[model samples]
Target: MNKTINDPNSPHSIAAEFGVLGSMLIEEEIAGEVIQLLNKSCFLVPANQVIFEVMTHLYDNNKPLDVIVLQEELRSRGLLDQIGGSEYLFSLVEGVPSAGNVEHYAHVVRDKSILRQLMAAADEIGTLTRSGNMDTEELLDRAEQLIYEVTQKKAVNEPEHIYNLLLNIFADIENSNHSPGLSSGFPDLDNLLSGLKGSTLNILAARPSMGKTSFALNIADNVGVRQSEGVLIFSIEMSKDQLARNMVCARARISPHKLSYGVDEKEYKILTTDASVFAQAPIFIDDTPAISIREIQAKARRFKTKNDIKLIIIDYLQLIEGPKEKKENRQQEISFISRKLKEVARELDIPIIALSQLNRSVDARDDHRPRMSDLRESGALEQDADSILFLYRDEYYNKETTEPGISEVIVAKNRTGPTGSVKLRFIKEYMKFMGISYQKPT
Candidate 1:
């Protein structure tokens, strides 16, 4: 058993006492006290391995972790000596029997309750640090650390891990697959975008009645029904029932005008049957109007956690509010919202399809085709978005023009690929946007 130093005046005795300094000294003596502590905790790795891992991670990330922080991290790991007072720790440092042998060490420190408590505290700190506002560089370092840790633990044969090495090649294949081969729902648009990637922000902009909502809904429905991925649509301007009605009409090939006016008995039956089919589709809608960015993020996270939502659609970015502030201008607020949405996309690792309204400047032009500058009130939308798509219908501007069936998806800004326009078929009554020439007028 380690000797308890009862003397108050003896520095050696005080050092030997099992108080804070003793625990801290013991931690320091171990060389990798933090790594040891973390290793012994739920991480379930060897001390040397943990040290090597964390050190390598920090080195790779170019982060310099201070000793005090490392000590705090160890204390968080429940590795500090809580058993015999400073005397016990002093004995360990002094090469006494209690500290010399692992069996003796275990026998001397019988109560591990402090260890559990320390572990819990450490876990709380880790969680807080991960979620709290840290500098971007610090956050990125931590993220890299986490990725390293997770990847290290992953099985060698894991498909995703193996594929990650060849990510660029896989991306190329994915892009190739997205070409306008056939009408799998807006093939031309897919050819331009290479399909919306996971963890990307795809902004769709258009004037009112130019099929912005319709086009977004069509894509969402296609993804949900064909790909069988969960999709969440937040319709800020329309009601859930109205959105559902539009989807049903589009899927059933019934005109929205006819559905809204009156349906014959046969048509009513067809609509009801089609609606039943759509009920099984993995598409969810929330028609909450004037939602804040925070609210959208919270809801998107909830949907992802609960239902594994793979895609999120926010109708009209202009309506999204920023943090409560009395003095911020509209442009600033919109900028904040746009950046937040992009952050949300990256954090959630899912595609966010946000519909936006173009400025009247486009309408004033003779061409009337929307441009990147037309993303109303927020230039950050152009900066933050991975892709920006403009929806322009020729018939909306030219009443006498014969090209009423064509819609152009202008890729005004693409962060990862070429920017160009792709044509699609816009069926207004059906509320559908399909790949160009996929459907013929009856």
Candidate 2:
């Protein structure tokens, strides 16, 4: 059992830190076990941290880790004198009674590291709140974001045995009546993707005017209204009112221009009836512009707790801001953003469908279909995503094409199943995509 301490210095466990280091030194083979629970940052004392770093370095480089090898490593780095030479290293070994409690000692070190992180976050929050730059909600949001980042950083990185995984696999096989994961509301597409799996990131890419937003909203409405599952959408490009209006158009079969103008009482009744359904739907939208990926994750977590959100959708990925200090360039920044989005999906245990814009090079090609390479600024988005989908409508490029009302959903990549395209009818007036249903022969 883990005990909580309230004193300012209670977070530090000096003896435990030494116990972990000494345990690793005694049985170098167990270095892998110690690394699993504790890293160099877990140690509170400066000298202990230095010693831990030397051991971690040796382990990572495939070098033998005994007191002799450790001493040479510290000497080569000129940290031997700084960390009190060979005598201090031997004292660490003498302190540990046995290697059996190394994991417990490492847990103590890790717990203290997390507590210190919490304290720092609280201090930062206090400083920011006193500055009076943000309102109450923004202040709370920022504080939660900081604290969540710390919690996410110390996630248990471990490998699970196959026996533990086989249990869930067998259960899923037995319960094969309903869809696995969440359904996408399309039979063929659902078969292609067994629905969107949890802890997966899916990319939905298209060029401008290809109805990416409309498609995303369609899926959101299906999950929120049809399945009664909570869904959260981050609309960085459009306002909440615009999204509501789109819902009305799609549900009521009314045009955008007609929505703005007051129609007759009969039309008004139709629009209101359609709008009422959306009002009751469990679809929440946030229209924060240029929002960072970290902010999106934080907001998603809050909604998941409060509203039981099961799915997250981000309309267009490039609009999201990346980390400020660590970004090397736009490509690297995008790489960082894409990587973080994938991490958010796994950490939150939900599927994230992030809309993306394909590079304009697709326009210059003879075949304007989007490929994996077309994922804008960062190829990392393509690499990180579990599935990649492309939306193509031939009518958009040539008004007089043979295929006028058809839209193709190209399943460019599927991590778990077969890849193929599903054809659907596109109604531009109402901004809706419908699956093609075949009639039985009379």
Candidate 3:
């Protein structure tokens, strides 16, 4: 039904609707582009709506478009005379300045249409509230979901040719070394897995005090500082300050105890000067403990849009909570949480590194090495992770071991490449990981 102009609050623009139709008539190529953005109900003028409906029909059925074709079609459907004959259609093509702005004009019409829908939604919600029948929470959820649908409507993608796909693949292959996807800060690791491919869930697992959190923080700092990329760190176990102190220890090569407990003048000077590196780095920390997956997903999405965040690091997976309503089993809940994290990675098109804990079975073994089965909630984490890295430090088990400071990142599961171990030096005092080849000053 056409909205009467007497109602002042009805959201509609007659000029924008006419502009979109006129531009489409003037240029045939842009017809599809503008048509995809709007529909029949987007117009305030009923005649404009009828003209657009007929124009879309002509374009859809392979008919060559012109004023004559449109008039004949409207005449055949008995709408030409009702729409004020060919005179109104002639005026439709007169005022459009450029066909290039058709899509923009269409967007204006669509936005007005959305505003009208919001008005109707508000009325419905008011009616529901007056009746007092629906649950308050359910009503709020439905209202939010309705508004979200309006924002999500967008132009759909057409099929891409194979040549385009080949170009992207070749480009990625050529740029795999240093500037590929978000850098791992390790040349060897970047070469191994192409610097943490986008839309992947990377699991860094180990027993307690194995430096998984430190390793993730180090990677975050590397990407944030070196690449100047936005990084969001969700620290469930450690506070934001603890994370920053640990980061300082790793980046500055200072002792964690001194940075944490107290700092002397010389050490304080070093910490303050070195800490400036992080001041400019685009790193955001959220230290909410036992947060649910839903909340994390919401925050990650908002951050991705606001900051254009390139990487997300959850300190450890075990500390996260599932939905408010408890599930039947703890393992199932853990599986749900990990899967949700994977969705966040894919939706934002970024790499998400989630820390995990290993079962004590690895400690019972004489070798004291962890594997895929040692994942605390075994089945789901292994299944959902695109890559699994098990951290093992020989010094943690045997003090007089052959390689005292070397930590092994056992690539147990890699969807993109070969599975093996990458050696890095883990400094216990600083809570830092360095390349195995890095030498200390004796």
Q: Which candidate's lDDT is highest?
A: 2
lDDT of 2 by residue, 271-338 (tens): 88988897778899999999987788778878876787889999879899887754668898888888
Shift of residue 324 alpha carbon in model 3, Å = 4.4
Hey, what RMSD does candidate 3 come out at?
5.9
**Candidate 3 local lDDT, 1-442, one digit each (tens):** 1232213469878788888988988888888887767877777677887998899889977797777899999999999999999898888788887788887789898888877766766666677778887766546645654444345543224565687689888997797645457779887787777787789999999998888998999899888998899999999999999888889877878888875478788888888887998889999999998876776877777787678899999978988888544466889899889898997888678999999888888999998888788999879998999999999989889989999889999998989888888999888778888889887656
Kindly report which residue pairs in candidate 2 clash with one another. Answer: none
What candidate 2 gets wrong by more than 4 Å, as runs, is 1-158, 326-328, 438-442
Question: Could you tell me every candidate's TM-score relative to the true structure?
Answer: 0.65, 0.67, 0.75
Instruction: Encode model 1's per-residue lDDT on 1-442: one tens digit a residue.
Output: 0011112221221222222222333343332443233222221113322333444344334455433444444455564333323343334345432322333232222223233333434454466577877754444444443343232332222233455468767786777744421122666566667678777888889998888888888887888887778889998889999998888899888887896579899889998988887777889999888876767876777677768888899987887767666126888888888888887788767889899888889889898887777788757888889988888888888988777788988898887788998888888878887766577557
Name the TM-score of candidate 1.
0.65
What lDDT would each prediction earn against the true structure? 0.64, 0.83, 0.82
Each model's total of backbone clashes:
7, 0, 0
Off by over 4 Å in 3: 1-97, 100-107, 113-180
Rank by lDDT, highest first.
Answer: 2, 3, 1
Candidate 2 lDDT for residue 162:
83
Error of 3 at 326 (Å): 3.7
